[model samples]
Target: MFAGHDPYLVALSVIVAILGGYTGFGLAARIRGTPGLARRLLLAGAAGFLAVGIWTMHFVGMLAAPIPPAAAYLVLPTIISFLICALVVGISLFFVSIGDPSRQRVIASALLLGAGIVSMHYVGVHAVSGPFHIVHRPGMILLSSLIAVLSAYGGLRIYLARQGGLRLVLSAVAFGIAVSGMHYTAMHGMTFSTMPLDMVPMSDGLVASAQVLSLVVALLCFVIAAGFLLFLVPEPRPRPLAGFPGGFYPASEAPGPVSEGLQTASRSDRSVMTTAPLGGIGQPRQLPVQRIPVEAADGTRLVDVTEIRAIRADAHYTMVHDGQRERMCSWSISEAETKLDPAVFIRVHRSHIVSLPHVAFLRKEGDGAIVELDGPQPTIVPVSRAKIAEIRARLGLTKTVPPRH
Candidate 1:
């Protein structure tokens, strides 16, 4: 029979689980912000810790109970439990990697992670010593699974939403409770026992809580060390790839040998030393916005950057607004913003970036401001309430608008 009641261990496990889950989420969130090899190593180490922590926490809960003749786990299945936790951590972090994950994708990833957690719990359950048939109450099992999924979803949501301070801690606590609750609930739902006379005594191979702790600590240390080594390894600097034209180029116009300074600029960017009368073999590279080259719908024609006015996020790529024409470029708004000169182009909204020089007038309508540009064809851009001050400063509007109620 399994260990009966162990509230103290369960409570302790819950606390540990929450802290581990939260720590993983926090570290995973920081992964992208960290540059180069450090980010990759840190992400792996963080994922490993979260996984191992959850696995060990379950065993800790197991240790809380005292079964007849003492309870021990089979070695192989116990090891597998740790792997399941790591899988869950890896999957959760992967979902967070997407800049803007869809709701369905996020929920699905969380549900899958929870399922792995559930699997880990059962695997540990099976690791119990002795040949015993285990039966689970269907209703209880489903309820526990639901709890795991919901808990995982909540934690993922908080991490993706970038919740801070009290909220984040609360989310961690909630996740921990879910982990503990699932373990105890599953433990109670199952009935496992062997015939007294036929039951085999536990052997040296059986896992103890101490063994689990040592294993987890060792794996955590390994992960951290691997990450540190990765951090030490310098990442290769990105070299400028072939210039983008999406077509055959004349021999004279073919890409020249790339220089060190030009390596940072995208190959797709159309850069010239200068378009001025003095433009020749060696002049400073053109401004970022001026360097952008656009391929026409026919692909045979290329448009200069001066023709472009504004850019907006459209599906996966950005829509280049050039007078009456619109061209789709395979670049995200954020990516495009980095290449453009900040003084000329400003990201006015999440999806919208506009050329400041194109602005003819700013009209105030209630709480919102609309920018109408002066050109052969006028384009109206809506400014969000959050960007009001930024718009004012950029547009050089000395008058301060009253705050909205």
Candidate 2:
């Protein structure tokens, strides 16, 4: 017969689940903005932490249940259960992270993940061998499975939406509750009875005694706690621009007149930017931005303005294309236009800005036009009808009129 649960251990199990969810989802949110090896690493880390969290929580909950002293866990089956959880969780994340995930793909991934969780739970349960027979109620099993699927679906949706700050914390809390609820509900529907005197206990493989299992669970709890704390620390911001007094000039202020000797310094000698004093006065002279600040999930990074090929508006934010990939920026389209040098960067459309120096090709498309930007990943940015003529002139594509016949 099942005994009353240890309230302390039960609470610890829920905490582990929440921490795992928080770290996993936070890493997954950055996968979109990262490229190549970095993206793969983030994905792996996310999956590993999440799988460990699930496995850890289950065992902790199991420990809380006062099972008979005769019960011991089979080593192979217990390990296999964790592998099942990891494999399915990794597969689900892969599906959602690659390209644009459609509704069907998301739903399918969630179902797969849910099924994996259920399988892991049952496999772990069966791994326990003792002098008792376990019986489960069919209704409870169905209800637990349903809860797993629904919870997985909700978690995936929140991740895709990129809900940060308080929303992400709330989602993690909800996930912890659902995971714990499923475990306890299944336990509620199960009853244990003593086996017949003639029945022999299973002893085919290595088994973990309750004491040994408890130690392993305790170590894992520490690991999860450390990871949770590490994730809470804010990522470092981009370093200040070098060679400028009090860092770079504020957006509203321009650099004051420089001494003649400093202005005469060769461009090659200057590491960041060259300065000039116009008319020997303190009047503000418009200077092109040398670096643009962009945002990633981890922190802010400054992208070289020369490397930027195009910028497209994303709601209030902007996506800066630096030939290789597009990165989210905190600046709006209008704000980006004002900061960038007018001579090199042009506003080709209300929602789009392009670096004129990087334009490789231009052609008429419908009423508007299209521009092919040169980069590792070719980008085609659209030009609005009203701006088409301006873009053509900017790109030196304006046709000259012949002398009058």
Candidate 3:
């Protein structure tokens, strides 16, 4: 006889999934803009939590059921399932964070993750050796797979929406529920038949349920403690400097998109700030733009600096292209230029500031140059001769050939 509804394992699964959500958000933040050893570390860490959390939750949930005949898992298959979960989770995070958010890429990631999760669930289920024959319903399996894919998309969306705070918690809870939901749903779809009394004693896998549960519980404790310590470390609030303008904020304060201490061309310093203007002096300076909220006159539009493809001058106004739509801003291109971070937004023309991340590549076109942005349909913006050297340097190209007479 077996008793279901074990409280200990259920609780551990919840804890593990919540911690994994937070880790996934952090991993997404670290994946942006640049690639390095640090980013790789974030990827590996998040993969462990995301994969292990689901793996642990499923097995723990299985134990909570208290099924009959004292079933135990095959160690090799159980470990293999965990590895598959981890790899899928890692790949999804990689696609969402490191690459451009294309429609096809996002869909592919969701489907891949969904399929891997389904595979992991079944593989883990197969690990059990018991005195019962497990029968599953096809409809329930399909329904559960849909839930996993949607959950994958929802998780990625939340991470992109915000990296920290209550958003992370909500995303985690949703993820945890999806995991437990799939397990229980599949469980509900099954009807187990007990083997004969003589066959019961022939069961090979030894019960190590207690040992496994104990290990998961310990890991959950460690994850909870580390999460609080790393995320809860408070920062001293910055005292607002009166009238120094928004650029006065320290570079460390810059959020996910841009690097810290990114210099902007000042009114008097425009001549020395960027390459084409560096040797020249007394270029009219513009103020740095904070993440300003701008909308069209109809009040139906909004754009973020991070979303900008390029800003084109239109006399007294500037046009902002966010890859999806274009909106006109009241500010001139010069005024908008200073408000952008120099590291990621470069002055390609006197009339344009190109968003660096969207730039696919540069092309030299008949004694001039063009900067192309990445998307389904690419946009090419002309680069001025004066600003060409600066653009090259920004893209990390250092070798400059002198003009031949």
Candidate 4:
């Protein structure tokens, strides 16, 4: 039944839907892990739920506005508008969902979705009917998107800090409540309406409260879903025969805890590079250590080893040098790695390992090519060659690619 709709009322409906959409996406992402049929089904369900929930919420909120006799004109456009809002919000949430199973991702996802919903609603409101008129200013849209992204990032950081303990759940609750409250508070601000609160028993508060509760409860369900999904979809198992170093034979007889620890430390570095000292002029440098074997995820074999003369840790990753050879790696040294095995590293590239001290020059050609050292001489690291840019970045090289023709 169509009824009277006010600008503020429309805004309220959109905000509620945004909250619902964010909650739904986060829940779906957490519950669905695999990338096949099951995940698709779960995602479809989430999208449907978001579409219906937002549409219904807004439809009800627009009760104050006069309805046109052209119901058909309204229905289709309304569905499309609500869907666009939900999809934008859901996509933001999707980005946040790919990170580690931390509370931060959930919160970030929620905030991003919320902000998307809000921005889209405001923009839509400006276009359709509201106290604010559409400006069609690209700057405003960019600014709004930027703000939303920042808020999402902040939410993610907060969530991450509060994950893994009873405090995590508490933080989630607090975050959800805070967001829901903020949504209502902002919605309430849309109008130049200085009108006093229209008291109709607890009905208004009840609806608002229910929506908030739903958002908070949905977040908790997402947490559970994420946990279970993580459990179900195990990490990628390293191939046993990918690369085995001479000493790294039997899984049991692999390096002891110390070596294991070192490998772990290397893996965690994430931006390590190994380079060999350049000859006379400013050239590549080698790492201090030499002959470190790259370990597979499975402790069974060693993918490869590099010779480095020096090591440099990048802002985000690690680098190691072995003579003229250079290798870039993501694995970094952490306290945990100090207690692991020596053969626990991964060979992301021919010239790179978990260690940053064994990388040579990373060269970009057609696909990608890395130049590393076998002994003291530079050996062409066999890689796809497409990964060269990635290698350079990992090595902290600042050279940019020439423009394509």
Number of the top lDDT candidate: 2
lDDT of 3 by residue, 277-351 (tens): 323345554444446444443343446677788877644456566776445565656556656776678767656
Error of 1 at 44 (Å): 0.9
Q: List candidate 3 segments past 4 Å from native.
A: 1-4, 7-12, 163-166, 200-207, 234-405
Clashes of 2: 0
Q: How high a TM-score does candidate 2 get?
A: 0.65
Instruction: Judging by TM-score against the true structure, name the best candidate.
Output: 2
Q: Give the Cα RMSD of candidate 2.
A: 12.6
Residue range 140-224, candidate 1, lDDT tens digits: 8998899889878887776654423455577667777778887787777777665665566545564665456546645654554
Provide the clash count, candidate 4: 90
Q: Which residue pairs in candidate 1 have backbone atoms (N, alpha carbon, C) closer than 3 angstroms, thus clashing?
A: none
Arrange candidates, best lDDT first: 2, 3, 1, 4
lDDT tens digits by residue: candidate 4, 372-395: 533454444443433344445556
Q: Tell me which of candidates 1 and 4 scores higher on lDDT.
A: 1
Q: Which regions of candidate 4 deviate over 4 angstroms? A: 1-26, 29-32, 46-77, 99-115, 123-151, 154-189, 192-405
C-alpha lDDT score of every prediction, in listed order: 0.64, 0.78, 0.66, 0.40
